[model samples]
Target: MDMDVRRAAELARIELTADEAERFGGQLGKILEYIDKLNSLDVSGVDAMAHANAVYDVTRPDESRPGFGLEKALRNAPRKTADQFIVTKVVE
Candidate 1:
């Protein structure tokens, strides 16, 4: 068992204990069998699917509204000038 396990591990370039190789081989065989069952299904007429089939409400009349962000916007700043945020000078 150790020789077979070691040889298989060497062929795959993986380090596996004697127990782990046997364990993984059984698990992998089951997964491959499940995939084969899925491949046997006939989806000959089903269309390739997208996430959802629906249209969104996208059209609305634009309206003019007064904005209200002069005071609260600059309240947390260390420096502000005339209803605008004052940032540090970058150019000399």
Candidate 2:
């Protein structure tokens, strides 16, 4: 288990202290044990689902609405051209 933990850490490019490796190894063992228990369960009758509860879109339908005009939108800009805000170039 400790070796497995160390290998996993190496693959992940993570540096774990001796204490952390020991702790994580024990936790990983417990997780694997739980997974084994789950695998033993008969799940042939259960349907796979993405979520535990039913999910549905609850959003309002899109509707066209008047937007803040360019003048109002650019009113707070520190620097602006006639029709657009002037910001420093982010990319070459």
Q: Which candidate achieves the best TM-score against the true structure?
A: 2
Backbone clash total for model 2 is 0
Question: Compared with the true structure, what per-residue lDDT tens digits does model 2 show for residues 5-91?
Answer: 999899999999999999999999888877777778899989999998899989876998889999889989999997899989999
* Model 2 alpha-carbon miss at residue 57, Å: 2.1
Those runs of model 1 whose alpha carbons end farther than 4 Å from true positions after fitting are 1-12, 41-92
Candidate 1 is scored at a TM of 0.32
Clashing pairs in 1: none
- Tens-digit per-residue lDDT, 1-92, candidate 1: 12355676799899887789878778776777677786788999988765577656797679867675778767798987887888779999
Q: What are the Cα lDDT values of the candidates?
A: 0.74, 0.88
What TM-score fits each model? Answer: 0.32, 0.41
